[model samples]
Target: MWKSRKSLVELSGNLRLIVSHARYGKANFHGSNTHPHNRIYIVEKTKSPDKSYIANLSASPGQKVILRPGHVYFMPKDQTVEWNFTPGVTFVAFHFGLEIFRGIDLFDGDSEFIERPVSEDFTREARELMESSDDLGHAVRLHGMIYSLSGMFTDKTMKAVEQARELMREYAPIIHYIEEKCDAQTTVAELVDHFGMTRNSLSKGFAQTVGVPLKTFMTRCLLRKVTQQLLTTGLDSKQIAEELGFSSEYYFCRFFKKHTGMTPKAYRSDILH
Candidate 1:
């Protein structure tokens, strides 16, 4: 079922999941009169289209564009677009709310639109699965399709982010050493020796790329580890503190509360409840 703007409730709640697999055989104007709520469209065509457009932008076949089938097209609630469906064009489309795709900075415009062709095999299997199901089975098939489509974008985005993160990964040995010897009160000298860089150069490069002082980042990482332990394990504050290389449980509690605005115990309680 195609949803018009008037009946949208998914955007208000910040996220929604839409799943469908079908063929569009007629020419129709999508989003001609009203904007859909925040949504991502994943469409796979059984037959090739002559042309299509999102808003005023045009898409051609096999361009590695962002919104192609097996990929995602994220758009805000107030944006407008048009689709010119060629006859015999069979496609599966999925819609997701904007919140579901928050923090992904792939598209270059206000509307998160990416259009490119996807692998024919994947598209065929997805379409087949959707076609052979109904109700809950259809829902399951659609969920799987969404999962696959989301992963495609996520993998691409993560690769881009990972390029920026590689410098930090290179410093992983030092970071791990610090975490291990936190009680021994490691110094910058030790990190410098292990990484074979002058203190000044190391600090400058880390700050430029990671946007945090090395010491500050180390402390944050340690604190995060402690927080996870507190939440997931039965360990007390003291045990967590000691494991994270904190000088004392009181100091750890104070540090955690300072950064997180809640005591570790309180945070754990809130999460659990």
Candidate 2:
């Protein structure tokens, strides 16, 4: 449904949201881990009759949030959170990413985790999404559920999102080109030539506007594609490296580990499990 407000339409016109992993069952995770994508959990039961919680080690050494039944909790990407759950806890969990510009995450710099009570309307829609049998219908419902849940956590980032939407408009074509070239092992010099801009201008402009050097953004674009394949496909490291234009499996593993702090195999196993 299209909204009447022009600002709303323009701001969200290029938004991209991907829900990569979702699961529902008894809470079975323990220990600390970092994920490269955003995550949300809807609590159904507590660890005990009391004391249902997870600690955000990134925010502080031992900051904990109490999980209440019917509450939705969000943990930002690339941050470590410690899970202290018992068999009695259960949840519906989704791991997803949201971007306002190509490769630019909406919650890019957020380190704090947040929680809010699930609304009646959202819970009803989630039920419908779970019951849906048609594949396309299920995907649509699932995306809607994630988008709605995302709204609950965006209060801190809303202003930044709006600012980014405005700042990145002039560089949209460059962003899109880099995203398209992500699988090709593209380079900053290639972007300079293709865009017909001098090295200095291209580098300075991109860094100023996007908050990262152009080369850094290119690396992020490649990392995003690599992680997406790792999450969604059965391709092994060698195949992924060959398909994405990496020189070799060893180099690909090094690059992935250098940027993400884990090898592709470990990332896939940790997230999938």
- C-alpha lDDT of all candidate models, in order: 0.51, 0.79
Separate clash counts for every candidate: 6, 0
Candidate 1 residues 167-239, lDDT tens each?
4565556555665664425567777887799999988876775555777656644554565576468899898
Residue pairs that clash (backbone atoms under 3 angstroms), model 2 = none
C-alpha lDDT of candidate 1 relative to the true structure: 0.51
Global CA lDDT computed for model 2: 0.79
Which 10-residue window in model 1 sums to the lowest lDDT? 99-108
Residue range 1-273, candidate 2, lDDT tens digits: 955877667767768997778766666557776677899988766757556678887785557888787788999986777876777876778888898877788888788889889865665556555555759868887888888888878764446677777888889899989877666468778888998999999999989998878887787677778888998899999999999999999999998887766789988877776
Query: Which candidate ranks first by lDDT, i.e. highest?
Result: 2
Off by over 4 Å in 2: 1-4, 49-53, 57-63, 119-134, 156-163
